[model samples]
Target: MPERSLAAPKPALIEKVLMRCAGQCAVCRAWSHQTICESCLGLYARPLPRCWTCAARLPPAFVGRPRPQCGRCLQTAPPLDRAVAALDYRFPWDGLLQHFKYHQALDLRESLLERLNTALSAAEVEAPDWLLPVPLSIERLRERGYNQSHELAKALARRRGLRCKPEMLLRVRHNDRQAGLKLEDRAANVRGVFAVEPLLAARLRGTSVALLDDVMTSGSTLFELAGVLLQAGVMSVQAWVIARTPEPGDE
Candidate 1:
């Protein structure tokens, strides 16, 4: 009789072991059941005063204000009615986001979503009528294998028991990269790039929506999309981003 080969461990069992064992925190290298660990989250991701419209970090003096608005936003409001960010685009978060966005580090999604959800809860943000992710163009979607914003929106909708309308917004055209571009140029870069799905446009009429994205730099992309949504009769548009870029030279 031929000897039988030893059975290999199942993928589910290996996943279970990984979940049970403590792993190194991405920030402090501390052993933890979480990716970023609770301590690091407390220190690095503590809520701070942010602009009501753009989610920019406000001066410490504005800490207790009911609605903190940054000076830039005060001069001219952004398209978004409100915006909230889970973390700043800096340090360890920048690196981690890069890995998640470009290298397919899908495991980081849970911890990232946890931080965003906690921030949203603490902010006492009202649930919108729908959660819509800023869509990617066909070429980019094929290249990336996933829409990061859609993934975030789906996870957030699940946590909040809200509707996620991924198909409601569509990226109709490819735009130049906004990095290193001036604010006006960035705005121009994204203009006319987004449109609402004709079939579903009526459902969005007079309904508020929250847009989910991984990061906001100049925020041109989100603002542009918000304008399109508003034109399609969306009552209000709010942005929920995983991170916001700090002001220039603002350590």
Candidate 2:
């Protein structure tokens, strides 16, 4: 008699093993399910109604107002035309980001990219002409061995059938990390830190582009990059981030 073929392992089993190896929070190791569990997700990742233009967490008083941008944005507008984020960067979520950015756990890129893809689909926005990941300084890239944002953008572009231009935006200077800094200092830390490749300027002209990043804290980095892209004559710029840190008043 012919030998029988072996049955393949179940997908559920594979997922369970992967989740276990990734630990509870992927970065926090706090007893989560592949970075987050359903209960913790409900408690920590609850969605806050946000301003459409600037992505600021909106209060009930501001809901249904004529303009959706927050007062700050109204006074001093951000450079990018629009922005969207999947979750608030807090608690277990922040831990996950740390793993991807600092711990070299590149495997987390897949899950983060999946979440960003969902945000894009739910927004119903048109796919941009090109996608660019916020670039890192060569020094930082050499130290980290990878740019988490670029990895995420590459995965997103491949999944969505859009072009990913990881090198379009280059980091012109190395800046200190923005974490733990006040909002006021955030902008200064990122100022003059990015530039567009001169040869890529013509391609960006008259084109709409999407900028991808692992997390957006004060949005200073995104704003700086968008400013450069706009100066390069890009028709429009939008930001796509894995998470956004809710402003103090938002809580």
Q: Model 2: per-residue lDDT, tens digit, 26-129?
A: 44357765655556556765555566656767787765565477778878888877788888787667877888898776656666666677777866667899
Model 1, residue 18: distance off in Å is: 4.6
List runs of model 2 lying over 4 Å from the truth: 1-35, 60-67
Q: Write the per-residue lDDT of candidate 1 for residues 144-234, one digit (tens) a residue.
A: 8888888778877977999997998888888776776887799889989999999999999999999999999888999998999999999
TM-score of every candidate relative to the true structure: 0.91, 0.82
lDDT value for model 1: 0.87
Q: Scored by CA lDDT, what does every candidate get?
A: 0.87, 0.78
- Predict model 2's lDDT versus the native: 0.78
Clashes of 1: 0
